[model samples]
Target: MSYIQQSFSVQFEYKVFFTEKIFDTANTDFANFLESRAEKGIRKKLLFIVDDGVTKHHDYLQDQITAYFENIDGFELIQDIIVVPGGEASKNDLQLFYWLVNTLDQHAIDRHSYVVGIGGGSVLDLVGYVAAVSHRGVKHIRIPTTVLSQNDSGVGVKNGINYHGKKNFLGTFAPPAAVFNDATFLATLDERDWRSGMVEAVKVALIKDAGFFDWMESHAGLLTQADPASLQYLIRRCAELHMAHIGGAGDPFESGSSRPLDFGHWSAHKLEQLTDFELRHGEAVSIGIALDSVYSWLTGMLDADSLDRIIKLLKELRLPLYHPLLEIEDDQSAIVAGLEEFREHLGGQLTISLLRAIGKGQEVHSIDLAILRKAVNMLRDKW
Candidate 1:
């Protein structure tokens, strides 16, 4: 928790800026929050869920809360640890889910209780959904420490685990009461995880901010190194794009009509399922954006330069152009099959979002598979 150098808090009703810090006095923000919870006589167990990767942490910033403020007298702290292998494996079957519910039930987690999620997307996604449906809902806060979580996963109020070879196959729209960000945690991101997150940031730029994309292109090398200034800018910028969509949308879940916040996700989610979640979510989106751009071109919606530059820009970010895991016996047929899942994901329509130009996109129906195959072939050769 770096000293929130400014009085860092933003009220959406007042105004929203990309760089607004949600916590002013961050140093005391967390501690005072718990103290308030305690002072109000909020009881039941406060469970913190940690997977193996996080539990193996030689150092955790949150330890400060427990070590220094554990005796604030809010209620008893009930910490239960789940040693997940980390990453997508932790989002597996219903059994792991049952284990968490059982843990909460055994500990007697009540409506008055709260669960704090303190890891990457999978941990927060799983725990948040669990708390939401637990006894029909429980209080929870997200302290998103990873770039992927902070930039994309952390803001939205949806939580669920993958099911039956699908990513986020089960979910509900559940927003957090509070979210804490510690850019300090980004220091520990592995090269792979860090780069994986940049894909979403890049996607946001391509969709919403061309100037930001130009800035990223001009500073690709420096950006890749995890510089504090660049990382902070990106985390804040990406979060804003996600927040804007969620804020403006009529429906949080995909029902009736889907939201454009999905942008590249139609392909990204199915790609994750098609590739078995082996590729990172950011990576999948990068590739999906590329795929969508080509579909746009094929439909005569996007021009050539926009299409080429889109592919080249993603290349600059180091996301995979294609994965060996997505190998298709016939590129054309595989894409048709791939498109099938995307259509189904959006409620059985061929409604597709394709780029008309940079920062310009449109959702239309009935894309041609022949053009889709060419796009697949173009990307497939790169892998």
Candidate 2:
């Protein structure tokens, strides 16, 4: 028998626009976004899904969205905007996934229709999955509300929800039709969300741009204090770096094992699950970054000064550098199990990113278990 091989490539492009007060009719960003794709005499249906936390804070949000689309020649806003549980809770339950699909079906949303996910990263992940899977992919737009989403997750192409108690166990490699990062939604975030979101920026800076890391060091005070200009610049710069990596890495879908951007994510993911997601993503990342940095130091790969700077920056930014769960030892090396899980997740050899310097990273296939234990103990002592 003979075999036949076929190969083809598809082009992917989407705009990531930064705007404030997107739903205000006076602010034409949202309208412009929809109208850009409009055909003469054709009205596109829109299903707006809001996060419960966001609705609680902005009670007028649904009304505002309806008013914004009223009589808009290009789009029709569904009268009922569905609000779902926010945070990791939205991702942990698989029921919400089907519920969203059923709701879209009930509203007669088709491929041409738009599903706008408006909330933090979790809501975006869940809603984006719904849009990607239902009816073989509808046009989905992301309106990321939290600082974390605005800077990192919202800008990326990956969409995922937790499965079987694993972080991002079920997900897709689908990109949104567009990503609208509305800075206005950031103002209402509680202090925890406000501060935790910047952790991704620090992670990116430490690995790819030392100068950016320097900038973060200088403005750590402002970031922690919620300075608007500083935060805006941070988010934009972080998003730009992430987008650059995705465009240049030759692995946007992460088909390969080298995940440079996930420098601190292995432990972070495990920490999230171990804590039952009580630790916010960014907070868990902060600890992961610290754990990895200390491990790098232990292995003599990173200088003490660089490790000090990294830790100081995180602490100054009010990010948690140590979590007690990291020290927990049970029937197995609980936290160390993250290494195997991470490898399993990658579906190949273990590939981890460790610091070579403040602005650079190196990938390794395996980690020294003895050194890893030492790093955990070091963090415990500091705590």
Candidate 3:
């Protein structure tokens, strides 16, 4: 069977666009797309908004992207625009969406023009947000560089950046024209970043792919170490897990994570806010997952083995199960205060995904200031 079967998925009437073998196939897909556009008399220049890291080798991959399609529409149009360094750090309102939006406006890019994001989740998020708001939305294509983007952020079509210390505080629900996921980019990543991506893979499995999580438990070390086989399995499974549920949920653009099937996210987002984005999102989520699962156990929603198993998997992956920053906090009161921001930011009641049992998850109102305090205290003592 083609890797396409392993690489992409579409569901529930929501259009999902993807280039499974990005590097090998991107140019051909673009050529075919441009040909159709030309036949239809569509006039549009492509903006190549790329990440700095992708260009680090400037000698090869980066320049190759621009050179591959230096001109299209038979060279009649200017056909060029490159944006800034891409990342979650770059996702700040100042450098990413704002810069790209202004750049497009200054260049007089119209609805006919399109933006192509070339980087990991951050670039995809920020650029997609810019494209959505530019002239009331324009065409945007996502070339997700990292695993986090490919399996989770990239395919989801939610866009925006962190603001005022909140992650994804400002953004929109705009799907892209397409997405490209090249396993080759995995080669460019170091160990730390590769593990960051695995956190998302774990989250996907925790949500619905019980079997995937089972595989993850057995291969956590290998996955952390960047074993290609382990990495490939995690990527494809994570992508499939999310696509299954995202296709059925309410619009992902409305904020508050819009879907708290993201159980560990409440505390996770708070931890990130406190860390000034230094803590990788996946790291925060791993900690959050642990805390949340412990809460589930405490309340009789889960038993000891399930909680231990979850934390064990994370530890095996080398992801932290506790927030080191929480150590400085005076008491549970400080921790409770941190979680409140997550509830307030979403502009809705606190919606948390909780576990009734392993293989079963449910949402509930407020994690309770008191219960959260207890959980924090217990985590501190245990860690």
Clashes of each: 2, 0, 0
Q: Candidate 3 has which clashing residue pairs, if any?
A: none
Give the least accurate 10-residue stretch of model 3, judged by summed lDDT: 12-21
Candidate 1 lDDT over 313-349, as tens digits, reads 6776677777554444564544457666767655666
> Best by TM-score, which number?
2
Q: lDDT score of model 1?
A: 0.71
**Where in model 3 is the C-alpha error above 4 Å?**
1-27, 33-39, 57-59, 70-83, 93-96, 250-258, 327-334
lDDT agreement of model 2 with the native: 0.91
lDDT of 2 by residue, 1-383 (tens): 89999999988999999988888878998778777899887768999999998999899998888888774887788899999999999998899999998999999999999999999999999998889889988989999999999999999998889988887888888988899988888999999998999999999999999999999999988888899999999999999999999988899999988899999999999999899999999999999999999999999999999999999998898899888888845426678888899999988889999999999998989888878877888887875
Q: Give, for candidate 1, the lowest lDDT window spanning 10 residues.
A: 13-22
lDDT of 1 at 225: 74
Full-model lDDT, candidate 3: 0.71
